[model samples]
Target chain A: MATLKQVAAHAEVSVQTVSNALNAPHRLRADTLERVNRSIELLNYRPNRNARSLRTSAVELIGYCVPNWPHQTHLVMDQFLHALCAAAERTGRHILLFTAPPGVDGMPTYDDLHARRMVDGFVLSQTETHDPRHGWLKDEGIPFVSFGRVWKESTQPGPWVDVDGATGSAIAVRHLYDTGRRRIAFLGWPKSSGLAEDRVAGWRTACKELGLPTNGMAVRCREDSIEEGALATARLLDSGRDLDGIVALSDVLALGALRELTARGIVPGRDVGVVGYDDSPLAEVVSPGLTSLRQPMDRIAEELITILTGDQQPAERLLLPELVIRGSSAPG
Target chain B: MATLKQVAAHAEVSVQTVSNALNAPHRLRADTLERVNRSIELLNYRPNRNARSLRTSAVELIGYCVPNWPHQTHLVMDQFLHALCAAAERTGRHILLFTAPPGVDGMPTYDDLHARRMVDGFVLSQTETHDPRHGWLKDEGIPFVSFGRVWKESTQPGPWVDVDGATGSAIAVRHLYDTGRRRIAFLGWPKSSGLAEDRVAGWRTACKELGLPTNGMAVRCREDSIEEGALATARLLDSGRDLDGIVALSDVLALGALRELTARGIVPGRDVGVVGYDDSPLAEVVSPGLTSLRQPMDRIAEELITILTGDQQPAERLLLPELVIRGSSAPG
Candidate 1:
């Protein structure tokens, strides 16, 4: 690691002359260029400086760091990530992917990425109330954006975009009520996730606001899986609760409920009614079909990019989740 | 931008001296370093480079470029990507993310990063038959590794680590036959993707090898969505085809197939056995569960990282997808 100045001193020239000879040779005498080049070779120097210092820049890559995914093999997230990868290409940004498995106390080695400067700003998904990644990025001064909001505060930190989970759930519940269903049930994930919590709150609030039951059969979900949904449905039925309508937080759970109902000789539209969220393209494929709320995928994708690139500021952009009415909850 | 050499010349020093002043000042004579620094300030010359280059030498950046993964959203690559990222960190390396979008064709703008030099090598994913990125990267003469192999012969082509799709499919078919399922149907993506094509080929080969019938009731699905799977199942049933057993390319599709069977008053595991690939968390979530093949995500991830870091130069690594027996394929 000999210094370029040492070489310059050895060559009996000022540093400016050395810089001119090495970087802007045309502005320097040919002999000066030759001497400076020889000095650089002698020093065995490699320009390991950050690319930002350069006048011309490269948009050769982009990156995403999803740490709070529900699970590794989750079917829904799997599909979203795939779409993101494809979408990244459109922006001339490639996804540098990273995962931080939760450790004890629900914290992972997120600082490792920040310390080493892994990728250019990251695309963070599944924001929580007090996400550590947000503060860590600020301390490390790394650029990043989120797929969901990190806090419930009025003046939130960071640029983030998210699917309208609350609105979707509210719409589902509203639809069920409209179909003359008084006792509606909400099925889906445990109330641990921020998104799930939002959906749950919306369900309960809608019921209370609409003068419907706020507890008991109003919410009968125990978990996120299809089996759990089915098992929960069976429990609701066995408990002799008067539930006539159902709104699941997710299509997968809704599907499980449907299976349980069908097995019990219950027809979705006639005997009981159901509505699913995510519209998951699966709603249309299911028999009797399913009424669902479709997420605004393109808008989320676009907003995420804009924020990550510093092209957009922190703003609450909520796109309406479309209510798709299929056979399952067609007001029959 | 004012060139470093111009600064050096203006400051009356060799370019090496100027570089030493900015990049390695401590190694130069204090007086000389001061002179170079003063000259740089006077000339205001800057180098064009990726922001990452400015970090310490021994650049450990290993970029991974993907060709838009729209279909991958459901696959939840978090576990795999996280493992790879963790491995890279252990070996003192970083992963760069890059994606190619719809309108953008050929290589992304790499003027600053590639030309000015940002990363040491790359880790490419979703390699196509004749990947344009491959040719362009090859021309740049950058050392790289791949999670998938590019088509055609290349001079000093990078190493690849991919799942053995053909083997997995064949095993699935054989398992069905072993279970006394002679009229088993195949359900999966169209024969386009190299991996998908391999699975189809393997299914056919396995059928032929086992002397089993390959016609009728077998479904060729266009997508791996659960809804698509259900629709395909409905199609087969509507056609009145005799399908004793079914193999879906993905867990989502298999779940859909199970739903269709339920709708038609058919017991999934008892009446007609069903199997799925991907072993998604959803597989275990569904009632009667699902018999599926599981890809070794962690192993593939580790292999990709090791190869990219030059710890190993594997020509191509093939991982076996194991069959996870579940309730869906259990005979009553």
Candidate 2:
């Protein structure tokens, strides 16, 4: 049961060199590899280090629960999953995907997989303030990293990497303001969602700094969908808010607003600037192209995998989203 | 090393009774469970059955190469992946996702995962004729099932479950024909792709059966994208083909056609009937809901898992795509 450092000491080499001797022998001289192997045998390290080596020889697996929202568009999650797979592969790990039984959350499956050692750790997404999985996994002393904030009230914290939604909205507001837009309205989802509220905060801060009227300039939708967005836009227009720009929290809502504007013969970009978030494929495909904020999904995935695999205490990373200007946000 | 059947015989119980004793003990009577355990010890069946039970106790994993087509919209694959994950979970398996190195295909990663015993089998998609992975996996004596056909010219074939693209096109054609559209045109990709050709075949067959002119009715695009589809639609129109309906091979192409028609002040349903394949979210979100063919992804995933886990020989399943009628194909 000798530690890797002890094996390194016995072999008269660095700990990294001992690891290279076992995992990447080509990186070491023949004599060094021989010395490390000799030390490993003499110290009876097979029980600990050899077993670990055998496990490492195969691909390590990280479990992810595939969210089943059939009616919802999954462009963001789809992009993130692809990026996560690429990031995990770079570190010799793979993503093992599971789904809960119909109408159930993924806790039971997570428990079963953890109990049986099917995964080294987990990568979570779509987490909320009171997600039971966070507390449950923490209580079980399991390793996990979420793509979004855990938002839990606990003495201990979980690792996470999230996009700066507030900053994304702030950037959108500033861009719209700089483009001759004095009155910018925010189209956002219900405030019950932490993620949605974060975006709204950005809009509020940016509007107040720009000395623009904030009263009656923001509209909340029941959900993030095209229909809801259109309905909210209709309310903004009918209320005589005299808005010249609209910054929607998601592309779906933005597209909905565009649909309403087009129906009323009001040209987007020319008459009323419109911007959305996520920069999904729909953004580019939509006519006049959608001005959107693009989250750094690849970088976030890389960070998540790093935190999940590295033997470090939990880390929190908040990355800024980049505003991608398109025809919809073109200055008049 | 005694088998489960032998253990059942020794315990004077049904095979299900013995299995329940090990896996679902609550389903068995206390005395029956005791008898099964006693028989297992008496016959020294622990070596074989215990190992098998232990292996099954942990979730079996099916390897999937996460296709990294960043620009392409992945509605179909995204839906299929969710379905596959759900289906795998129902049968006590999971999907292990790996991505190939940037700019590389997935063969190397697949071989690595298979060599390490990290997965029980594979589920492939985006497969093409003469796909090297099929031949390579066959040579390696690995188990795999493709969501698409492996059109390799080999005696030993791979198991696959594919949606009938030809039938999908035929259904579109027939639907368009029945909807008072006398002249139906086909917008499809170049002939090099086996899948595109299959779809074209359906259009051709249906066009001929309905005694419609096949010549000069089909237009081929270099790729299946919105832009290419628009260009192809333009070509079809400028050629004076007098087509009143268009059936696109994919939703992207169909959306492109819609964009072109809308730009030219031509209404979709009234001026030119349109239908698309893959019934993606775009089909619903598009201005005029697109009438498209919906692939039975859930059923296909179920069949693929059944073939992969069962000891049966390779099976080929060709499920039909259902045409979902919507605004784009409404009768005028």
Provide per-model DockQ scores.
Answer: 0.24, 0.26
Q: What's each prediction's clash count?
A: 55, 0
Worst 10 residues of 2 chain A by lDDT: A47-56
lDDT of each: 0.68, 0.81
lDDT over C-alpha atoms for residue A52 of model 1? 27
Docking class of 2: acceptable
lDDT of 1 by residue, B1-332 (tens): 78766887787888766665665454478888777777767766665443434342424556654334544443435555666777776776656554444222635443123433455666666676666655566555655666766644464355677778888888888887777777777787875666667777788888889887777646777766667898999898787777778888888789888988987889998888898987866777787889999877778767777776665443678789889998888753
Cα error of candidate 1 at position B12, Å: 24
- The prediction achieving the highest TM-score against the true structure is 2
Docking class of 1: acceptable
Model 1 chain B poorest 10 in a row by lDDT? B108-117
Evaluating just chain A, the predictions reach TM-scores of 0.73, 0.81
